[model samples]
Target: MIDGLSFSLLTPPLIAFTVTLILTGWLIKNNVLKVLDHPNPRSLHTRAVRRTGGLGMMLGVAISWASIPAALPISVSLGVALLVLVSFADDIFGLPVLGRLLMHGAVAIWFSVALLSEARGWMVATIITISVVWMINLYNFMDGSDGLAGGMTLIGFTCYGLTALLAGNESFAVINFCIAAAAAAFLIFNFYPARIFMGDAGAIPLGFLAASLGMIGWTKGLWPPWLPVLVFSPFIADASVTLAKRCLSGEKFWQAHRAHYYQRMVRSGLGHRNTALLGYILMVSAGVSAMWAAHEDIAVQLGVGIVWGGIYLSMMIVSERYLERCPGD
Candidate 1:
C-alpha cells in the first residue's frame, strides 16, 4: 500500500472522475439533458447532445471539499456554490439577463466582504470584486467552441499549481490540482468532435473558480497578478477588443453572433480543432512570458506588456480581414 497517502493527493481527481461518469450516464438515461439542448443551425455539432456538463464540475468540486480538511475558504466555497446553482438553473429554465447579472454582482460582493473581514482593505476589496466578476464573464463568453474553456482551465490551473508548489503553498496546490483534474476529465468529452458541450453551467463556474483562485494566490503573495493575466491573456485580448469594437459599431452585445477572433478564423476555413490549438499556442507563449517575468524588473514587465499588446492588435487586424472576406451571416 502507498504510505501516508493524503486525501489531497488521492481523492479530488478520483471523486471528480467518478462524478463525471455518473452524471453523464444519468443525463444520457433520463433525457433531462436533451430537454434544454438541441443541435441548432448556428451550432458546429451534427447531433443532439447534453450541454449541462457543468453539473459534473460542480459535483467534483463539492466532493473535493468534502474529501479535504477545510480545503477552501468558506466564502470562496459559498461563492462557487452560488454560481453553480444560478448557472444550472439558467441551463435548465433560462434565467433573465438582469437576474444573472444580479447574481454575479451579489457573489462578487460576498467575496469582497469576506476578504475585507479578514483584514484586507477597501480598495483591494473593490479591485478583487470587479476582477472576479469580469473574469467569470470572460470565461463564460470564451466558451464558444469545443474544448476551449476546458483547455483554458487546464492550462491555468497547471500554471497556478506549479506556482503554488514553488511557493510552498501546499494547500493552494491541492486546490489547483483538483481544478486541473476536473477540467481534464471534462475535456475528454468536450474536445473537438465533442460528445457533449459544457454549456454556460460549467463554463461560468469554472471561470469563477479559476479567477478566484488566481486572485487568492496573488493576495497571499504566492504569485504575481501578472501570472493569471498571462495565462488568460489570449481570451482577455480577444474578448476585450471584440466588445470594444461592437460597442463602437452600436451592435447588440448580448445577442449571439460569430464575431470573436476565433469564430472568424472558423469562418475562414480554419477547423475548430486547429483554431483551439492556435489558442493553446498563444496561451503557452503567454505562460512562458509569465514565467520569465516572474523574476524580471518593472521595466521588463512593462516592456513585455507592450510587446503583447502589439501582438494582440496584429491578431485583431488579421481576424477582421478574415471576417470581411467570409460570407455574410
Candidate 2:
C-alpha cells in the first residue's frame, strides 16, 4: 500500500466533497432552486429541474480554497474569485452580454498577470489571457446538458492530478485531486436527466480553474502547453467551429442558439446522454494524446490537435446533414 495517506493530505478534497453534497441537499430541501425553466425549442432537457447545481460546485471550490492555508498564489485566488462572482451573478440575475464579457476579460488579465509574470513578455500574457477567456466562455456554452460540464472538469483535472504525481508535485497534485473529487461529487447529481443543472456559475469557474492549473503546470515546466489544449479539445472544437459558422452566416455572436454541434447531434435523435458520452470519449482521446506527446516533439502535439479537429469537424458535418433532413420543428 502507498504510505503517508494522512488526513491533512486528504482534508481539502474531503471538505470540498462534503460541502457540495450538503449544499446540494440543502437546495433540494429548501426548494430554493428554480424548477420552472422548462425545456423549450432550444433546451436539452424535457422536464423542469433545478437550474442552480453550479452553486454546489462553487461552494465546493470556495470551501476547498478556504480550508487550504493560502497554498495557492494570491493572483490565482483573485482571478478565480472574480470568475465565481460574475458567474454566480449570471446564474442568478442574468447579466448583460457586455457586462459578462468585460468581467471575463478582467479575470483573464488578472490570471495572466499573476501566473505568467515570469513569462517572456506582454505578447505571451495577451495570448494566455485570450485563451483563458475563450476557454471560460466555451465551457459555459457546453454546460447545457447534465453531466457535461462536470464530466469535463473531472476528466481534465484527473489528467492534471496524474501528471503532478508523476512529476512529484505533491501539493499541486492534491489541488487537482480536490478539484476532480469535487466535480465527481457534483456529477452524482448531474448525470443524464439531471436533477440539477450546473448553470453558468459552475461551468465558468471550473473552466477557469482548469485553464489556470494547466498554465501553472506549464510555467513550472511540469507539462507543456498542449496538455490543457488537449484536455479541452472537444469544447474548443465544438464551440469554435459553431461560432465561426454563425459569424459567417451573420448571426449575432452573443445571442443564444441551439446550433452547437452537440446540440445538433441531440436534435438528430442521438439523445443528450449519448451525445455527452461521445464528447467524453473525444475528451479522453485528447487526454491520451497529451500523455503520449508529453515527451515528444511539438509537431506531435500540434498533430494530435489537428487530427482531433478534423474528426470533430467530420462529425459536425454529418450531424448538420442529419439536422437538415429532419422535419421542421
**Candidates in order: C-alpha RMSD to true structure:** 2.4, 2.4
C-alpha lDDT of residue 56 in model 1: 75
**Weakest 10 consecutive residues of candidate 2 by summed lDDT:** 1-10
lDDT of each: 0.77, 0.78
Q: After superposition, how far is residue 8 of candidate 2 from its true place, in Å?
A: 5.5
Model 2, position 310: C-alpha lDDT score: 83
**Please, what is the TM-score per model?**
0.91, 0.91
- What lDDT would candidate 1 get against the real structure? 0.77
Cα displacement (angstroms), candidate 2, residue 36, comes to 5.5
Q: Please, what are the lDDT tens digits per residue for candidate 2 over residues 1-329?
A: 43565564588888878888888767656765663456777687888777677778777877786766538776667777777778777767878989999988888888788765667689999999998888888898888876777888888888887787778787787788788878888888888868778777778877788778888889888888778887778788878987888889888877778878777677778887887788789778788778777868888767876887787779877766778854222
| Model 1 residue-pair collision total | 1
Best candidate (score: lDDT)? 2
